[model samples]
Target: MRGPAAPPPQPGWALKAATAVVYAAILAWSVFSRGPEGLQAVAMLALGYAVILGLIVFAALAFFSLWRRFRTPRNRARVMLGLGVFLLAAVVPPFAEHNDDNRQRDIANAEIRKAIDTLRQQAAGGSGAPEDVPAIDPAPRASGPYGEMERVMKTVAGARLAQHRAYLQELQEIGLPRLFDARRLARDTGLIESRLILEQAERLVPGYRRQSLDVLNGMPALVRSLTIADAEKDKILAALQTSNAASNAKLTRLWDLESQILREFGQMITLLDDNRQYWYADKNELMFGRDGDLRRFRQHQESVSRMVGEQEQLGVQSLAAVPQAPLR
Candidate 1:
């Protein structure tokens, strides 16, 4: 008679329950740690489930072994240790990567904020004094079209465009109420700067009034974009005072309008850039002998004008597409 009746066989239900608890715990931890932001959360859960499933399969195979390998406590302990190692390997990297990404984003946002403050100050006319203006050399003027003066003007225009683009991008990142404030600052500064540039152009090339005028005319369109954005924001806020459904619908329209406005703003900037190039090239032709450059320049101007006209038409269409309020 065997050693005192064999102890009752261990139930498979207990083993299954234990495995399920471990799986659930791992999944919960992954989700909570990642906070459901990106693919990393999904990946972590998938990997955890895969590892657990593999361990379940391995245990099943070992239990069915002809030699009964899993029957021994020592073999089971080794199997558990291997599973732990595999689980650790599968889980650690994603968390580390997510932490690094968050840290870098914080640093970048801080730098952007600092830059926006500096730009705001400069836009408010924080430059030192009128005496700070660097003196331009008064060398004898070259008769050729591509003279030193024209070169200098091109350089300055390019620099201004770059600075404006950076400022716009920064404003866009900050979003809303602040966006309007920054834009107002930019608009005021731009108008003043445009007038000054026009005056300088008149002095440099007396007959170049038309080109400068075209450049000046584009400035208002840019400013109008800012005004439209502000008006739309106000309208959205006003709409929120009504019923929830109407408010939500208005908000959707406002979002669509803001997107369209941004697109138009970008296009307007591109058009202005083209205008600047055309103006300088045209000025050069007037000074130097006419060449193929002038023909290409005119073609570019026409293309940009057509684009601007299309943008205007789209703007009108977008306004029309907005649903009218129901009569009370």
Candidate 2:
């Protein structure tokens, strides 16, 4: 007996509205969280959602077919509800997690940028220990692939900054004054100090260069430690490569500048010795001859002064080359 042919299935306006709101909210949050830079991520997310949405639509058509196959209205409603719940469970969690991962990556990149900025500032300014610098604000260190890389990057940054700080201090403290003491051929304490500092810097610079080279060389292996998606990994690796090249170039310039200073110091010492025969130390006066010792002395002084100016200019250029954002 057909007991009042079953009522036609009604559209569930409430469920449809709720589903629209959920999808809209996720899309909105994704754009908002990533800013302008996140358009690619947002597009990827939208594509994933669209695929899921299409599957849901197909499932709805299947559910309609099942509705006709079923005998009772009660059975149809149960089947629809169960399928809807299953689809919701499958679709929502992954997108939510994708959103979460986006937020986390942004946070980590910001921290890394901040840390690199601090390093750039320190190296450019070339003053004070790391303690004198502002402390990095604390945040949850990202776990997984980024965690190890982040730590190592910051460590390398710190080492570079420390080396520059030490170099500047020694240069100002001991290098410049005796560097220009071209008239002092005596065994003075200041000259001794400068000589010792020059030898120390010469010894330390190669070590510093070696350390930097090691860091650059090991970067490929370090990148391999990350277990992120291939696309993401390649992006990070590119930035790291740029950063390494810049660091290496700057380090080489610094080494050259130091070498120039050391070489000038040695030349200045030689000039003092060569001109010592022309000076009467007791009278603080010069003995002149037709041999052109006086002319050579004047020329040496001018050359030393010009070299000093050159060093100053090189230092300025080196500082200017420092990246405002190293990791970018």
Question: Judged by TM-score, which candidate is best?
Answer: 2
Backbone clash tally for model 1? Answer: 0
After superposing candidate 1 on the true structure, give the runs of residues whose Cα lies further than 4 Å from its correct spot.
8-25, 29-69, 72-78, 89-91, 94-162, 165-197, 201-328
lDDT by residue (164-261, candidate 2, tens digit) is 55555655564553444434434443346556766766776676667656655666665666566677668766766666666566557656655765
Instruction: Please name the candidate that would achieve the greatest lDDT relative to the true structure.
Output: 2
RMSD of each: 23.2, 8.8
The runs of at least 3 residues in candidate 2 whose Cα sits more than 4 Å from the true structure, single-residue gaps closed, are 1-84, 128-140, 165-190, 229-250, 265-328
Q: How accurate locally, in lDDT, is each candidate?
A: 0.40, 0.56
* Model 2 pairs in collision: none
Among all windows of 10 consecutive residues in model 2, the one with the lowest summed lDDT is 319-328
Q: How much lDDT does candidate 1 score?
A: 0.40
TM-score of each: 0.26, 0.51
Relative to the true structure, candidate 1 reaches a TM of 0.26
lDDT of 2 at 248: 61
